[model samples]
Target: MDEIRKNPDIVYTDKSGNRNYGYLSLGCDELSVLGGRSPLQVYSDFMRSFRDEFSNLLGETIMEIQVGMGPAGELRYPSYPESNGTWKFPGIGEFQCYDKYMLLSLKAAADQAGTVGT
Candidate 1:
């Protein structure tokens, strides 16, 4: 354990020939140095690192949407309500149907522009 803690890159072999890899923790200074500027800056750096590490493999970009309550406690909802009248619950929560449509429109535009995959 001591050896593994000292050198995390090292691989150990037991008497039974089973191999074990070491574990390491990241320090704040190391994170700042490697990530550069801030953690968000690391996103662009990932492309270069991934390309260099996996030159022979193909890579693609992906975009995702995250839905959550806003600072004012407002929640997002689907563009259109269910026609079956099942979603007509009262006082359940605030729903912003337009936001979903906006996101869908943006996604459609991105797809048409070839920025998003099929």
Candidate 2:
């Protein structure tokens, strides 16, 4: 909440004026600006880290990597090779394609009790 509100470009607000939360599209970071990478960079980094950690700890199929965010944020879906093509699991940054929320979700999912395998 604090992070989202700090950015002038992205802040949570409501007409009610009592309390509010809204979505904000954050641009890439310094590295993203210097290297010209899109939000996809962060997203992918997270995916890789999530998969590796989950596999090492929980050892589950994970079935698939569903990376995205909620109304408060975004963890945009795995970007296709050509905006219409799906490639292998890893991409440019490995875990660079995800945001904080996605990371948290992955942790929670891994912590849950399950078959821990396919």
Candidate 3:
């Protein structure tokens, strides 16, 4: 929350120009700017620590570990924000790529794939 408060661009912006704070958007890309780590990096570190600390419980006490990405730990975009009243149940969620970071990433991908025009 503090990060978003400091850098509003971290949040997802819809086509209608509304900022959705339902979860951190592509802001995860610029986390390093604020002396923070990316979400994937943080998760990787956590798995490493868990493996190191619970080496003995891998197949006994700890049977398995479930991992997820994105909001609510689910690998999905924050398309619907009920709190903002811009979306509702049963409605198709909006795309979450209006942020600068996401746009740059998309452009890079397109360029790499030769999909972007010169």
lDDT of 3 by residue, 1-118 (tens): 7776887667788877788776566646545634477755766788899899999999999998987765577877788877788888889888877776666677788899989632
> Per-residue lDDT for 6-106 in model 1, tens only?
43322222223232332111122123323134323454576578667766554443244243442234443332223324236453532231222234555
- In model 1, where is the ten-residue run with the lowest total lDDT? 21-30
Top model number, TM-score: 3
Candidate that scores best on lDDT? 3
Q: Which residues of candidate 2, in runs, are more than 4 Å off?
A: 11-22, 26-41, 56-60, 72-118
| Clash count (model 2, backbone only) | 18
How many pairs collide in each candidate, listed in order?
0, 18, 0
lDDT of 2 by residue, 1-118 (tens): 5544543333222222222123333322323422344346756877788767787555355555554474434644323232223235455512222343333444556668552422
lDDT of 3: 0.74
TM per candidate: 0.20, 0.32, 0.71
List the global CA lDDT of all models.
0.37, 0.40, 0.74
lDDT of 1: 0.37
Which parts of model 3 are misplaced by more than 4 Å?
A: 26-31, 34-36, 70-73, 107-118
